[model samples]
Target: MNASRRDLLKLGTLAAAGSFLPAAALANAGSGVIEKAAKPLRILILGGTGFTGPFQVNYALARGHKVTLFNRGKRPSPEWPGEVEQLHGDRNTGDLKSLEGREWDVCIDNPTSLPFWVRDAGKVLAGKVGHYLFISTISVYADGSKPGMTEDAKLAEYKGKDAMAETMETLRADIENLYGALKALSEAEAHKQFGDQVTIVRPGYIVGPRDETDRFTYWPKRIAQGGEVLVPGDGLDPVQIIDGRDLGEWMIRLAEKGTRGTFNAVGPDYELTMDSMLHGCHAVTGGKVTFTHFPVADIPEDVGLPIWVPREGTPFSGYGAVSNAKAIAEGLTFRPLATTVTELLTWYRALPAERQAEVRAGIPLDKEAELLKAFHAKQGA
Candidate 1:
């Protein structure tokens, strides 16, 4: 199954009633920032309806910039600000035919994972936009197994012969195997056109409100229910995640500063363990639950654990620990994990009964119970 399939389901459901989310339930109200740019520029967002794209649009609008969205108009975001300009044309079919002669001070590409998409957009926006920011991921790195890796780290190379195929079917077929290589190739396509004008943002797991993945949000919702929660690896394993809201704001800032080159954008700026993250969730939501930490090996191979990367031998070896020095030095900051958990729970709870029926990541209740039984039996033996 596509790991991000559920992320697409929640794309249109911005369940929050308004801009203000419940903060009283949260223990920490992260360092809030309202940016007032030195000079606002017109910004174009290639994909504004998905996970982090709306946040980017909202932050750009808040920072006083004109925002235009380019997509096929399949998923319309009703929650977006009313002023967003929409241009409809499929990059795969039209090669950005709708964007000809259009110009923006900066263009943000949040949905382009295919090099063909980048090449198509580049053909149109080459001289029109002053800055081109491509949203890449830490997955682009050749080896995430090594901790403290930075932007200069080795990148994954596309194994496929054709780097320009832009079909969702192609993505679905090769995601598990070639996703990283393709993403790195896409980043290269952006650079091929814009050179120094490109700003590559390699973010780790992006979580927070408006995130449909339920990858990180799984903890907040699960803990709030309160029970014998099955946890992995003694709960001391460090995990790294960057909030979508924080990233959205930082993108606008980077564009305003006209930043160029690659940056590893992931962090809370320090070490954060699984237990500390769960504590924040429990404290914020008042979940009266007891966690049973099991050895990583105890976790059944079939049971999926969200956010807890296995340690023995995995491609995501350094997943819990990656460096963000370059991005931090350029003014990237993070909100407390508490604030993220609280708001996420608040939003998840507000969803309709049907919307909250299933989560995309993490073990299901039935699987957890079975795994816990075996785990305890082994301990007794």
Candidate 2:
């Protein structure tokens, strides 16, 4: 049940900010309470059942905002703390008819990869909503080799024949190249449709509860098992991750304040290294473990390692170094890494036994042992 090589690469590339850790933010990490807005506002979320959607819904409800979700209604609804109206529609077939003539104070578009979704939504909710917020990714940037890349860096260009004609299936057919380009196009389309009132928040490596990818979760779960763990690099490479709740809550705050412009929503408020990240997870789990380090070149290409992208010589090396100062300036905050680990484990454990048995991501034990044996033999020789 080991994760595929593609999965590892996708997680490493697709998934930072800030230096000062907020005490109040840490205190409220596990709570359902937040500062209420000056006045209640109507909020519309395009997708509500995915990883970050639920957090946004829960936090918006906690802040006393009226919330509405528009989706296909395939997944069961979460036990929301307050009343939330659900509108059923599919963005694939251009079926946003349910959203026609609806008005809200703000609209948060999640789970949008195709540009046509934005175009179609604009057809319905154009002037009806006061503000539009789009959830984007750090991957939209063209270059990740330069450290400290900001929101103004060059964006990837869609090399395909026509951006508007691309679909999920076409993007999946060539994800590595198309995903970033298409997302960049989607951002432009958002600004085009929503005008200057649009807010673009690009986050990297969003890890927390309800995460089906298990990229960041793999480290905590593997380290908790207590044994020789395979770690990539010398442990000095920078690493940046934002909790789902932190990102979700900040988006709501931006909507409340009508914050505009693009921001790199990456973080711990300070710099973190791979060594520090793993040790932090172990500190919380109290797992008896030893980490064995290997150079990136020593590892087999097919054996995928999650959340350990090389700090040098790769296009995505800057992923761990992307700036989040813009987000921090806009009241963006992060929970401690330990808090994320604890809550993630709690959520994973509470899942059904059958679900827990499936290995979501990481190197299999047998493969790890084999790699370790070969590595040690080379060292001895």
Model 2: worst 10 consecutive residues (lDDT sum): 16-25
- Assess each prediction's global lDDT (C-alpha) against the native: 0.75, 0.80
Clashes of each: 0, 10
Task: List pairs with backbone clashes in candidate 1.
Answer: none
Task: Give all TM-scores, in the order shown.
Answer: 0.90, 0.93
lDDT of 1 at 180: 71
**What does each candidate score in C-alpha RMSD?**
4.4, 4.8
Residue 141 alpha-carbon offset, candidate 1, angstroms: 1.2
Tell me the tens digit of each residue's lDDT in model 2 across 164-224. 8988898778887888788888889888888887999888888877676778888998899
Where does candidate 2 clash, by residue pair?
15-204, 15-205, 16-266, 16-267, 17-266, 17-267, 18-269, 18-270, 19-269, 19-270
